[model samples]
Target: MKRNLLFSCLIIVCSSVQAIPISLEYQGFYQRLKQVNKGHYSQVELVFSVPNKEKCRIQSGNISTEKESFPLIITKEQRLFLPFDEKLKSDRALINLDIQGETKHCNIAMQVRAKQTKMEYTHGDIVEIQAEMNAMLSEMQGFPMRYFTTDIAGVSFLFEADSDVTVNIDGVVQSVSGKLRLSRAQILTLTNLKLSLKPKVISPWTNGD
Candidate 1:
């Protein structure tokens, strides 16, 4: 996860701060830093503040880049995943947080640890991937089988900015020697499966089943 995971937070100051739940402090936030052959903009959680529910209610939100703006809905928990980009800081992108109320006191946290990614996964990681796919399958009704067979066969994963990336299972260990040096696209697909992508549909003439 050397150049892969980037946790870039831009914080603004207000008044004094309050305490946050100790458990939420260790959560990870990821954004692709270097140029990857294939990738998508990752949505990383940003906590505006641990606000008093009575005081702060986000009515609406959005993010603006040089080209476009996308809706950023804040959850009732006061946390929302922002569309993260390595260039967002330099692009001077704007984030609009519309709050019905405000909290003067909030908590600020800082921590550091070695980053992790999907390629270096264990059995537990596979469970995490399974949960993600299950959520997708539940949301996108009537999806074509071809879309899932690829992952089921361990064949390939789709990338938004580039093409589908395939990995050699045998070579990752003994199957494909030196194949560990996968391109960025392949790496990203293995890691960021939570991305909300437009599901591909089966062709009318093709046997989707």
Candidate 2:
């Protein structure tokens, strides 16, 4: 009985850490508006909020359409997720956003890597890097963006071929693809993802508020 109980306990612990939590929430800049179908090239924005160790401040950041966005925040007990559809992943665009209340800002030229791959995420030490891929606009620098979170277990971002925009990862180039999305416990990933040139990811005029 003792041996059996020990084995069961070990299995539980292992399983608990094996399957990392991944949740995603999809929001657009037109959340409170409406518009008509223009095209794939449209201004888009996503905000990711998480629990902060320190209080007295908001727990959210904006990822605009002016630059790449990544290095999603994931703490020890929680992970954030951002799942991108095939259409947007393949087409890249400029990503930009503000940290909110802070003077820091991100303006990156991003695009998708022409490759196909996936990854296995679990509880472990994680480092972040801003991965930038831009086939157009030669004047921009392609590199990792500033890390907004720490003590992460795993991280991922998917970019499709048709995605004609820049995408900056907060850490190393984990994976690259023309189709993908983010997954986390609370979906706190993706601070903001707005587009500089576009017909709008979510048309407020057509989609409605």
Candidate 3:
């Protein structure tokens, strides 16, 4: 019978060539440490979810850490930036995704925190005269003056000065100097400072055991 229809068409072409046209999922990854000008910059953010409708194309990725091995540049709106090193001592990382041709692997875990603040001044060049005497004594003592503040990951100043205040280190300046002793209308404040990134675990990439 045509040799059993040519052995059932070679078992349906080897089961559609072992089927696996893309179905990788591990949609999470993050790491960011910033403190520029004084030098310190690190960033890593990768997310994937290609449920496979057929259009697959993301042909490169890698970010193994235990010493170093970062190389993942894919942007044109595809998004996946990972090459801004310096400040990743280790919090666990091992991601590799090369979609389309197949090659997925992940095991990420990071929860680092380093939002610093240190102040001390007696005359570090008078720190802009104690930030203009703490914004004119916080608008004539009406309050709402943390000696200068702004969010979105930048700008914070509270001075009383004794040292370490030269200014213009850029990276959105976050200076806090103190020797504690003001009277040009005294005003100094700091509350709820912040910076964060948490991605406990996102392991999911298996197909070949």
Candidate 4:
């Protein structure tokens, strides 16, 4: 029983450490919003002013759109989720939050984003992806615009190919194919990952983020 209890504790600790907490009130730039979307989940980037950790601490929150209610995830970066059908087609995104402290001025832009399907990669698209990735990384360098949450996995782009093709990042091809996830790690180690693949592997073959 003691061993079982210890194992449970370890699980909780490990989960807490791995899953980046979601923010209820923190705002992010349009370019800064990117994450690995899995089954039944598609997220939208709500442009919000950069939140200061010293001022903002989310107590609870939720969003109502198209008559569907999405509870704000205060404990995971997959904070606000919408159905795959409603992914980029939200007619409304009304958020209500209870913040621990008062925020001075959080100018949330009430604008919707243009619709985009899942990114597809082909033989010739490597250069394009690389260019966009580099541009995103460059812009993000000045403003590490995460929600001031616990951790950031960096900008993730989900790639699907017409045929099977291995994923290559920074000139290194990963074994991942068909469905791929390319992410920039937030730390010194640039962790390339195939997040959706059942046997998720963190490839340590890229430079720092």
Candidate 5:
């Protein structure tokens, strides 16, 4: 009887440990970075692809580097954003997500490779930038999407978009890719620089059905 009881307990523990949640894949990018009064702030957009038809409620999340961990704030729409220290020491970070209905944690390894360019104030340059930003905003409005922002110095803007955008940085043409969503602060940041907007396009596939 004692042996049987021990075997039963071991089986239960093994089964619980093996019952991990389905892994979710996500693509993240830096949308923008700007200089503030005392320091600089940045924003990153993460697009998550939930497995099967499972719904994800982001109970909590964090970004971990080699030295420190930064907590992330998630909006009702599932967008995540956070601020980091001035000396961002790593290009690679680990994202840990604590969601409901999972015994084990769901994690993703993401590459922080989004385009970053300084703003130019030339009349023609500003006009072109404004037009592009406006078009992106108009397209993303009213879509069920997530948004996040971070206030960290020295980290460049990166993001993953549904489509690709062409940008010229110091005379070099480059492409930025990701699904775009703009926070009110992000919109204001662009407006203050006189270069307004970003992108998002809604599709039936996004519903996760």
Candidate 6:
């Protein structure tokens, strides 16, 4: 992922923004470093001290400039991998973390990777898109968060977040990908209808299907 992924997290909200408690340790020594990209640039090896005594690392480098554009690789166990750009390409990017009300902004120097172009998707018609998505999720139970569907005709969803989700468009299902996202109001409405799933001690090892 591009280093700007972390930078994009720095959105400027008019109102106070709350911050997530993502523990970032700035005092640890990196344990390893290697070049994983095809290009040549400086690389940094990041090391972390996990609560369980387990360690993880993320390999990062740059292309031509000294700036590193790769986002920190975060393991599933909550270890934050931070990279320092040796060239310092961009020093003006600000990151804003909004959680409940408190907001904070910091200037972090970084670099971005070059963009590779491929065939793009033209904005599809919204009315038809909604119809297709509702039909696909018609039999789906529980509050759907976000998932991919390669069964649609020819349509493929890039990255579907908690918002910016409508219905699905059908055509060639070859590599068609789709995602399902619900809104706050929609969740509340689903709850009012007595269709909410209470949280439980679900085990990841067991499949609930």
Which model scores highest in TM-score? 1
- What TM-score would you give candidate 6 relative to the actual structure? 0.19
Predicted model with the maximum lDDT: 1
| TM accuracy, model 1 | 0.30
Q: How many residue pairs clash in each candidate?
A: 4, 68, 9, 1, 18, 17
The root-mean-square deviation over C-alpha atoms between each candidate and the true structure, in angstroms, is: 18.1, 22.3, 22.8, 14.5, 17.8, 18.1
Worst 10 residues of 2 by lDDT: 3-12
Candidate 1, poorest ten consecutive residues by summed lDDT: 200-209
By TM-score, how accurate is candidate 3? 0.16
The C-alpha TM-scores of every prediction are: 0.30, 0.17, 0.16, 0.29, 0.29, 0.19
Residue pairs clashing, model 1: 170-175, 170-176, 171-175, 171-176
Q: Which stretches in model 4 have alpha-carbon errors above 4 Å? A: 1-51, 76-88, 105-132, 135-209
Candidate 3 off by > 4 Å? 1-56, 59-62, 67-76, 88-95, 102-209
lDDT of 1 by residue, 36-117 (tens): 1122212111123333445444556666667877676666665555544655555566665554433342222211111223
Give per-residue CA lDDT, model 2, range 57-176, as digits (tens). Answer: 223432323245544443332222334433323334212222222211111111212122223221221111211111111111121222222222212333334555333333333333
**lDDT tens readout by residue for model 4, 108-142:** 22211112323333423333333333343333344
Model 4 scores a C-alpha lDDT of 0.32
CA shift of 53, model 5, Å:
11
Estimate, for each residue in 156-202, the C-alpha lDDT of model 5 and write its tens digit.
22233355655443344555565332333333434222112242322
lDDT of 6 by residue, 1-209 (tens): 11211121322333334333322222211111122221232221112222221211122211222343334454543344445443221442221111233223321222121122122222332223323433332222122222122222221223323333223222322222232222323323331111112111100110111
lDDT of 5 at 169: 36
lDDT of the candidates, in the order given: 0.33, 0.24, 0.29, 0.32, 0.32, 0.25
Would you list the clashing residue pairs of candidate 3? 119-176, 119-178, 120-162, 120-178, 121-161, 121-162, 121-178, 122-161, 122-162
Between prediction 4 and prediction 6, the one with superior lDDT is 4
